[model samples]
Target: MKWSEISIHTTQEAVEPISNILHEAGASGVVIEDPEDLVKERTSVYGEIYQLDPNDYPEEGVIVKAYLPVTSFLGETVEEIKVGINNLITYDIDLGHNRVSISEVNEEEWATAWKKYYKPVKISEKITITPTWEDYEPVSSDEVIIELDPGMAFGTGTHPTTVMCLQAIEKYITQGDHVIDVGTGSGVLSIAAAQLGAANVEAFDLDEVAVTSARLNVKLNKVASTVTVGQNNLLEGIEGPVDVIVGNLLAEIILLFVPDAARVLKKDGYFITSGIIQGKKNDVKQSLLQAGFEIVETLEMEDWVAIIAKNSADTKEG
Candidate 1:
């Protein structure tokens, strides 16, 4: 099928609002290019580990895109969307590709497409990730557990954020801790937490794909009974006090949700956060402090930092 690929370019500041504008302007759906996801997920694992220079990357803006069929009855549809988008977003909007062909793809092919991209990933002496297509034999002495075919979503223990979260879980999580993994993309951190002796792991993300992917990952890891994955925002839909909260998201979102997290965490509960750029470390620290938490330790790896902190008793005293 032929699709009119309407791609709009905007500044980082305007990406979200412009996306909303584009949706109002009558498009099918918008695809926002979040470079932060790639920076936090892909680059830290595959790209340079300890020395990520964000400036070396693009100014890091999203492409708000939607599709219109060639046979659509809307005349000057692109122009209408463009003008409405321009009014909402003060930035210039470059209409990228007009028409691109799309084909119906099957689930098997789509899931296995990453096979060529994925190889046997050895994160630590304890955990090794092997794609489903490949038959990998592990030496008996390695003491390595296998995560067979992490399907598709994110997180295969290969991304830096996932690696960092797993390492943090392995290090700090105690037995019988109720763990909440907000933005549980592919349920990597939650599953890791469950495996690491978290009593119960409740995981959620905004993306349905992420929820499905997370469930698949949990099943792949055989932690389905321990970890629960769903589509929800950071601790908002979840009730009760969790002992530990692990969020592998951009630093800004972490700061925004820390207060709620503080509310949902039991007194002295730990909040382990990663996906923070080196430059944003101090900001996150200050935000956590302001959110009524004490920074217990900051783990630095590959130019990124994961902060482990405990909630203060006086969080609600204000």
Candidate 2:
């Protein structure tokens, strides 16, 4: 089998949405090559970690890559991907050059090459996310290592929003807490919650591919009993008062679940929301407030924002 590597030259702001477009186009996986990884100041936690070659990254913008099957409709698929990328501009996403190119590769190369792009990334003060192939040892006894393959799922636990969400989880999750990881891509957060001592963790995603990926990761991380992965759209149909609910989702999707989140959390229970771009920060904050949540803290990393709120009282899931 052969695959076509679709590479797009774009800005960091458009990375998430564009990646989604590729996934919807039937791409097996996505790879991001951002120049910011070189000089973004990770001296504290990652500590001389990035060894990326400058030549591989564009000096000015980011490159997003994905692999799709070289099928009878390959050309049509590529054209559709281009059209989807062009559509992003209407949503105010800067595409930079938006230069897209395609190249052919063998099955072996596509299966193994992308793995080189992933490594042990120390995402937070106490968390280090390592891929399964990488041999990583804990730098400190307190350091928690999350091994993930990611596969076709979006969450690698390294995105700014995800990192902030994990940090928020570290700050708020209590022992024996029943936690719901809404939009839990790759089950990374659910695994983290279980490791952090949550007795029960429900990892939910609407996408079946993500559900399969999350379930695999949860089992691989030896948290099968502690974490349960399922398909659910945001917080819909979820019941029971959970002690903590964490979602790393788009600002619009986050808004959809804010009211439901409030209704399903116990009084004083925490809601840690991420995946919000800076532009939608106020909208999300306002929605959270309107839903009876009191914003306790706001965390920002790069151009993303994560809001930590608390449900003031117990309410039924409506």
Candidate 3:
């Protein structure tokens, strides 16, 4: 079978939404090529060598690629995707170059096309994200290694938003903390918390695919004993009162759960939120403040923001 390669030149903020649009349009999977990776310094600490080519990335913004079977309705599907992408602007999402391109390739080519774009990288000082197919070794005694296979789910454990959440986890998670990972795509954050010695961790995602993928990743990380993956909308019905709550979700979705997060979060508990575009940074911060959270710190990478806050509700369940 042949496939049409649909590639969008867009902003980091629009990557998730556009990727969703493509998925809904019947794309088998999506590949993201962000220019930031070109300059990312990777280590061969495990003696595994991989090289990245600059031409594979756009000079600015990012290129999101997806594969759709070449069919009679291919044109209609592309049009629908275009319309969906354009509609995002009404919601205040930046489209960057707003360029879309299409190409044709065989199924075999499409299968291996994305592999060249993914590689192991040291996302944080102590954390390294290596793809499941790669061989890597710890460079230091304190290094944390995450083996991930994104598998059409969102979290690669290297995206800026996810990376920020992992970094926050390493710093704020107590040795025996009970943690909740909201919208835990691929369960990367949950697995990270579990590996970090979290006594218990709950991974929640509304998408069934994400739930299954997260469960597999959690097991792959050998943290099934500590981390549990489930499907749930936001923080609804989450009986938390936990030490740490983290969500890497869109700013709008994050706003919807701020109040709920504050409700379940124990007094002095930590809240880490990411997947926020730079433009919506303040809106999310204000929402958190309104929900009885004190802003601890804000981290920025590329064009994304991650906010760490502390629940100041003054009510401890225990």
Best by lDDT: 2
What is the TM-score of candidate 2?
0.93
Top TM-score model: 2
| Candidate 1 residue lDDT tens string, 1-318 | 444556555544444344444444444434444355335644323222332234423345544445555555544776676566555423332333322223333444444433443456655535555656667677556434546444332221255555677777777789899999888865767876777778899899876656766787788878889998877867675665778999987676788888888888888988999877677799999988998899998877655678999999543332
Encode model 2's per-residue lDDT on 1-318: one tens digit a residue: 888899999988888878878877888888888878777875357323455666666788888999898999999999999999999877677799999999999989878867766767887777788888888989898887888887884322377887888889989998999999998877889999999899999999888878888898998889999999998888888896899999988787888878888889998999999988888899998998888899999988888899999998667644
Question: How do the residues 1-318 of candidate 3 rate in per-residue lDDT, one tens digit apiece?
Answer: 998999899987898888768756767768888766656554433212257677887888888988888999999999999999999998799899999999999988877767776778776667777878887888899888888887664322267777778888998998999999998877888988888889999999887767877888888889999999998998887775898999998898899999988988999999999989988999999999998999999988768899999999965463
List the global CA lDDT of all models: 0.64, 0.84, 0.83
Sorted on lDDT, best first, the list reads 2, 3, 1
Backbone clashes (count) for model 3: 0
The clash count for each model shown is 2, 0, 0
RMSD values for the candidates in order, in angstroms, are 7.9, 2.1, 3.3
Query: Worst ten-residue run, lDDT, model 2?
Result: 42-51
- Model 2 spans with C-alpha error above 4 angstroms: 46-48, 153-157, 316-318
